[model samples]
Target: MTPTDPGQQGPLVEPVPGAPAAVATLHDERALVIADYHAGYEAGLRIERGVDVPSKAESRRERLLSLLERTSVGRLIVCGDLMHSIGDPGGAERGELEVLFESLPSKLSVTLVKGNHDGAIGAWLEGCEIVPGSGTRVADVGVCHGHTWPAREVLESRVVCLGHEHPCVRLEDEVGGSRVEPAWLRGRLEPAAFRGRDEYAGLEWLEGDPARTGSRPVESPAIVVLPAFNELVGGTWINVAGQSFLAPFLPAGIARGEAYLLDGTRLGPYRSV
Candidate 1:
């Protein structure tokens, strides 16, 4: 995590513009938030199959704590998917969770918004508040996990941040093969953009009664989709030509906008964008 300069301002930061990095507002720098941690996911995979993969739970915790230290935040909000199993409890997964739960207090206040993956672990979360997908209001921003888009009221919040698609953008080198890295994508909502897509047909989680209705606007929020913190490494690239998953929102091409590449303590400006 790069320390935010007090004087930076723009619609997007440069280098890896649409990359899935967290942002700090000009007002309060102490409250830092991110999305889609998916802690213990590797352990879940190992249990589902016999494959042995090194546990990443501790490293992920350490990295997040280090990032918090760099950001100097007093609180951390995980938009969703803090756990991987839908409802089953695997031994390795349980151990990973224990490691994470035991390490929180030394860092900062952490909050986990219930995501689709957080099915059973809801009862075990400590030192964190669980918010529904109607989303939670932090300052003026709305935080949600993008497994489902939010309604109009949620979108209208100052900024809607989410994580779920594990969004990444591809960058090709001179030889032509490309590498996909997590990106932070940003764009305002236009009603017409989501009109015809079956994926955007309905909200996955609605707060009130099913019969209760008026015009519920399920717009894609002015979103900042964070990348998966897991090292398993796979994603949908936002910059690819004719890609459908992100086409509804990123039609204009992800690379044409500003980009910032996060390299440890140094965030370099990607001049191409």
Candidate 2:
């Protein structure tokens, strides 16, 4: 059985603008959800990559604060990759994250859903709740950083949210002008195929009225892959010929999914392009 959490009952889910990127909000729980902050990315820019830019952790924190102020939400859920490095948190990485948290409201709760790059991130996130890299349930939605198979709780949710692929669409005009835009990928689960997966084998879909008897049981779920929140982060050009979805659960169905700009334009299924 999927372990029950006290916070995963009812939720009002929607997308909200969170500055350079967007955040998913669960209105019922007063939470703002974001993914892939990649806190130490600036170091890579300045040192390894030989870019002249100085660290801008303070500026990023300010932008995040502005989004929080606009929404007035009490919970911040980072759906993974809070740090860029795939190893331990270094002093620079730790310091920047501390500054990020110090600027936030003291009353707000933060949850970190571990992503592939979030190794030892818990050391940097002192007071926040840390869930497994697999996933965690919040307000009836299953959210993960999209590397490994999510725990059963997340698998059984009506809506499953993912982040790691940093999904984007590459577009070229007939005259050769091209642009790549970070985007959301929305798609449906193929029930027969989804049921065949080892991870979801015996799990049953149990939503709807408990008092009513003999209602038909159902399967299939809507999958939503979020764009990377940091504008600096690169993306997977999903529609390109050799490009592919990264998450294990996504490879089978991602080609059938439609991409959407943050502004909400439907760009059609990835495979069709």
**Per-candidate TM-score against the hidden true structure:** 0.70, 0.84
Q: Tell me the alpha-carbon RMSD of every candidate.
A: 8.0, 5.6
* lDDT (tens digit, per residue) of candidate 1 on 1-273: 322221224222111222234654524634556666777777766777777888777777887767666666677777777777878657767677687767765656666777787886767666677777546666556777766655444544555666666656678889998876665544444545445545444433313233565655333334455666665746566556555552224432122233233343222322322
lDDT of model 1 at residue 98? 80
Worst 10 residues of 2 by lDDT: 1-10
What is the lDDT of every predicted structure here?
0.57, 0.72
Q: Give the distance in Å from residue 109's predicted Cα in candidate 1 to where it truly belongs.
A: 2.4
Give the CA lDDT, 0 to 100, for residue 9 in model 2.
49
Q: Candidate 2: deviation at residue 206, Å?
A: 12
The best candidate in terms of TM-score: 2
lDDT of 1: 0.57
Give per-candidate clash totals. Answer: 16, 0
